[model samples]
Target: MARNTIRKDENTTRRSKKELILRLSVYLKPYKKESAIVIGLMLFVMLCSVLNPYLLEIAIDDKVANHDVMGLLEIGGVLLVLNLVAWAVSIIRWKKIYSINNNILLNIRRELYTHIQDLSFDFFDSRPVGKILARVVGDVNALKNLFNQSIQLLIPQLLNLALLSIAMLMLNVKLALVCIALLPILAIAMFCIEIFSRRRWEIYRKKRSNLNAFTHEEFSGVKVVQSFAKEKDTNDEFKHFVKNLKKSWNSAVRLNDMFWPLVELSAGIATVIVFSVGYKLVISGEIAIGTLIAFSMYAGMFWRPIMNLSSFYNTLVTNLSAADRIFDILDVKPDIKDAEDAEKMDKINGKVEFKNVGFAYEEGADVLRDVNFNVEPGERVALVGATGAGKSTIVSLLSRFYDVTSGEILVDGKDIRKVKLESFRNQMGIMLQDTFLFSTTIMENIRYGRLDATDEEVIAAAKAVDAHEFIIKLEKGYDTEVNERGSRLSLGQRQLVSFARALLANPRILILDEATSNIDTQTERLVQRGIEKLLQGRTSFVIAHRLSTIRDCDKIMVVEGGRIIESGNHDELITKRKAYYGLYSAQYEFLNEGA
Candidate 1:
C-alpha cells in the first residue's frame, strides 16, 4: 500500500499543462461574478496609475516651464488629491478581492471535504489519508494565491500596459510604435518560460503532496517502525523523497529566475532605441526637453507593467496546476450513491437475507460465490472460517460497505440498494478487531457512536462493558485525552471502549469481527458478558477466532473457501464431527494441553 501511494504521487507529478489549466478554469466558475468585480477594480487602479505619469508631464511642460507658480500649485494640489484617492481605492480593492478569494477557497475546501466523505470505502482503501489532506490544504492554498495575487496583479498590470501605450502614442507616435514593437518579442520569451515553468511547478506541487503523505504514514505507524527497528530505513526513504522535492523546486525556480532578467533585457533594448530617436528629434527642435523626459519615463513605466503581467502569468500557470489536483478529487464520482427514489427507514426489524450472493474485488476471482443465508430478528449467527475465507466479506456485504457483484441483500424484504445509505448504516453497529479512536477524551470517543448520547448514558455504557473502572482511574476520568488512535490505552482497554461505544449506539443489528481478539482472558470474559447483553434484543453476526466465543450462538456456520461446509448449533455441529467439530476439537485440545 505504501509503495502504491508513492507510485501514484510520481504519476500525478507528470500531468500535462493543458489538463491542469482546464481543470482550474472549472473551479473558478463558481466565483466568476466576484472575480469580474476584482478585475474591474484592478483595471481602474491601473488607469489611475498610468494617468499619474501624464499628469507629471503636464505639470512639467505647462506650469514649471512657463514659471506659472499658481498654475504649478493648482496642478500639484490636484495630483496630490488624485494620488490619495488612488491609494484609498487600491486598498479597498485589495480588501474586497482578498475577501472574495478567501470565501472561494473556503467553498472549494468545503466541497472537497464533502466529496471525500461521500466517496466509497473502496476509494478510501486505495488512497492515503495524508495524501487527501495535502490536496485539501496544500493544493488549495496554491489555488488561493492564483485568485488573490496572480489574477489581481495580472489584470491591473495588463491594463497599465494598455493605458501607457495610448499615452505614449499621444506624446510621440513613432517612439510609441518602436517601444510597442519590442513587446511581442518580450511576450514570446515570457510564454516560452511560462510553458517550462508550468511543467516544473506541477512536479514541485506533486512532490510536496508526496512528502506530506510520507510524513503522515510515518507518524501514523511510528510505533511499528520503532518496534521493528526500521527508523533508519524510514529516514533514508524520506531523505530520498526530499531529494526529489529539492530537484523539482530548483528546476521551477531556475526557470522563473530567468524571467525577470529577460524582461529587463527587452526593456533595456527598447529604452536605447527610444533615447536614440528622441535625441535626434530634440536636436531638430521637433520636441521639447520636458516632452522628451516625460516620454522616457512613461516608456519605462509601460514596460514595467508588462514585466509584472508576465510574472503574473507565470504564477497563474502554477496555481492552475494546484487547482487541477483539487478539482480532480471533486470530479471523482462516488461509486456508491443514493438511488433517485431511495427511502429512509425509521424502524428496523433486523432480519437480513443474502440471496444468490456472488462477489469479487476484481475480475476472474470470486470471494463469495452463490452464498445464501438468512438471519431472523434477535438471532446471533457465528461465521467461522480461516483467514481468506468469506467470513469478513459476509459482514462487509451485510453493512453494504461494498455491494455484491451479483446478488440482492434485503433488510426486511426491502432491497438495501433502494434504501438511503445513511439511514441504512444507522441501523447497525460494527466493532472491528482493530478499533479506531480519535485523539479526544474517552467521553467524546464513546459519544462518537451516538453523538446525542448524554454523559450519564456514556458512563452507564462504559460500566456495562467493564471499561468504567479503568476510565475513571485516569487522571481526568472521561475527559482524559486518548491521544492519536488511543495510544494511551492498552489493546484490551481499547477493545472495551469500542464495546461500550457499540452498546451505546443501541443499534438493531450488531457486528463483531473478532472483536475480543485483543483482550486478555480476564478482560475477554467481561467483554463476552457485555456482548451477551448488547446482543440480547439485536440480531448479531460474530466473526470469531476463538471457537469458545461462538459456542452458544444460535447458529454456527463453518465456511471454507467461500462455501459453508457445516451449519448448526454448537452441540449439533460438534456431534456431527464435521468441519466445525474438527475446529472446536483442535482448539479445545490446545487449551487443555496448555493448561
Candidate 2:
C-alpha cells in the first residue's frame, strides 16, 4: 500500500509539472513578436562572437605577420565596429526579454489570484491562509528568475554554442572533433546533477511554505497565546520550523552549486586538450597559425555557453516546483457554482425550502443528514441547538455557500441550483458570527452592503439597527476609521456595525447567525428592539444561544444529531415538554443562578 501511494504521488507530480509547462507556454504565446526580435538580435550577437576571433586570425596571419600595417589597422577598425554592434544588440535583447518576462509573471499572478477568488469556501476551509498567500506572493515571485534566465541565458547560450561549433569545424575539423568528444561527458554529468537537484529544491519549497503557514497562524492568534501564557511553547515551536527551513535550504543550495564547478572543470580540460593537439597540427603544417589560433578561441567560446546553459537548466528545475504549486490551485474546480443554462432569478419572495437535503464535508461523517424544513414568506424562524448540531450548516446551504451533497434547496419553488448565483444571493443578506470589517471608514464599510446606497440611505439603515447612535458618538461619527476585522472597535460595536451593513443591503431574506452574541444583556435589549423592527417584513433565520432572545420568534426549531426533533412556536414547544422543554428549563435555571 505504501509503495502504491508513493507511485501515485510520483505520477501526480509528473502530471502536474507537464500541465504547468503547457500553461506557461500559453502565457508566452502573446509575446511571440517580442521573442522573434530577441532571437534575431541573439543570432546577430552569435555571429559577432565568432567573427571577432576570425578577425583576430586575419590581423595576426595576413595583416601583421605579412607586415601590412595598413591592413591590420583596417581589420582592427572592423573588429571594433562588430564588438560595439554586439554590445548594443545585447542591450536591446535584454530590454525586450525583460518586458516580456515581467508581463508573463503579471499574467500568471493575476490569473491565479482571480481563480482563488472564484473558488468555494471549502477550498479555503481545507488550507490555511498562509499557504494560499505563499503561492500567490512567494511562489509566483520565485518563477521570475526561471522565465528571465530561460530567455536571457538559455537561448543565447545555445545559439552561441551552435555558431561557435560551426566556426570551429570550418577552421579545423580535428580540434572540433575533440571538443565534441568531451561534451557528452559534461552532458552526462549535468543530467545526473539535475536529477538529484530537483527533489532537494522541491523539499526546500515545501519547508518554506510550512514555515510561512505557522508564522501567519501564530501571529494572527497572538492574543490567545498570551492569554493562555503559552508564549514559551509557541516560541519553541517557531524555532523548530526555522531550524527545519534552514536545513532544507542548505540541502538544496549545496547540490545546485555543483553545476558551476563541474562545467568549469570540463571547460578547463577541453581547453588543455585543444592546445595539446593543435600544437602538433600547427607544427606538422596541417593548419595555418591563424586557423589554429581561431579554432582554439572557438573551443573556449563553446564551453562558456555550455556552462551558462547548464546553470539556466538548474534554475529552471528549482523554480518549476513553485510553478507546479501555483498550477495546483489554478486547477481546483469551484465546489459551488451556478449550473450551465441557469436562469436569473426574479425578486426573492423569501420562502426557503429544504427537501431531504444532506451534506458532509467529508464522504462519511455527515454534519446534516436527511434534513427537511420549510419557512413561509416573511416569517421569523429561529434555529436553536447545541454546538455542531448543523444549525449554521442549514443557513450556509440557504446562502448557497456550499451545495448540498444530496437532494435540493429551493427558493420560491425554484431549485437554487437552477438560478444564477449572483441573482439569488443579491436578495439575501447574512450577518456572520465572526464580524469582519475592512480597514476603512465605518460609513464605507456599511456602504459596502450596497455600493449604490446614498449617504442618507446608509444613515437610515444605521438608525434602523440603532447603530447610528454609536457611530455619531465616535470622533468622526460614521466617517470614523476602523481597522481590519474591526479590532479597533469593541466586539459589540463591531457586531452592530455589521448589523447596520446588513440592514443597508436591504435583503429580502436575512440571516443572523449568532449576530447578537457579542452584545451585553443591556445592549442586547436595545439591539433586540432594532432586530424586531429589522425583521418586520423580511424572512429571517435567527440562530441564537440565548433562548430568551428567540421567545418571540414566529417558529422555533430544536435541532439535534443533524435532524430537527421538535419544532413549533415558543408557547407550543413549551407546552409539548420534550426536547424544547428540557433545553429551556436548563437555560432558565442557569440564567437565574447566574443572576
* Best prediction by TM-score: 1
lDDT of 1 at 73: 90
Residue lDDT tens for model 2, 238-332: 89888888998999999889888988888888888888999999899998888888887888788878877887788877887787788778878
Best by lDDT: 2
Ten consecutive residues with minimal summed lDDT in candidate 2?
1-10
lDDT of 1 by residue, 1-595 (tens): 1233853663453355567656556656877787787788777667767777777788888889889899889878887887788788778878888787788788888989999999878777777778788889998888777766655776567667778888999999988998888877777888888777878887898888888889999998898999999999999999988998999999988888888898899999999999999999999999988888889999988888877776777677667668667767777788778889999966889889989888888434898888888889998999998898999999998888888899899989889889999998998999999989999999999998899999999999998888999999999999999998999999999998998999999999999999888988888877667778888999999999898888889999888988777888999998999898888888889999999
Model 2, residue 101: what's the lDDT? 94
Candidate 1: worst 10 consecutive residues by lDDT?
1-10
Look at candidate 1 and give me any clashing residue pairs: none
Deviation of model 2 at 306, angstroms: 1.0
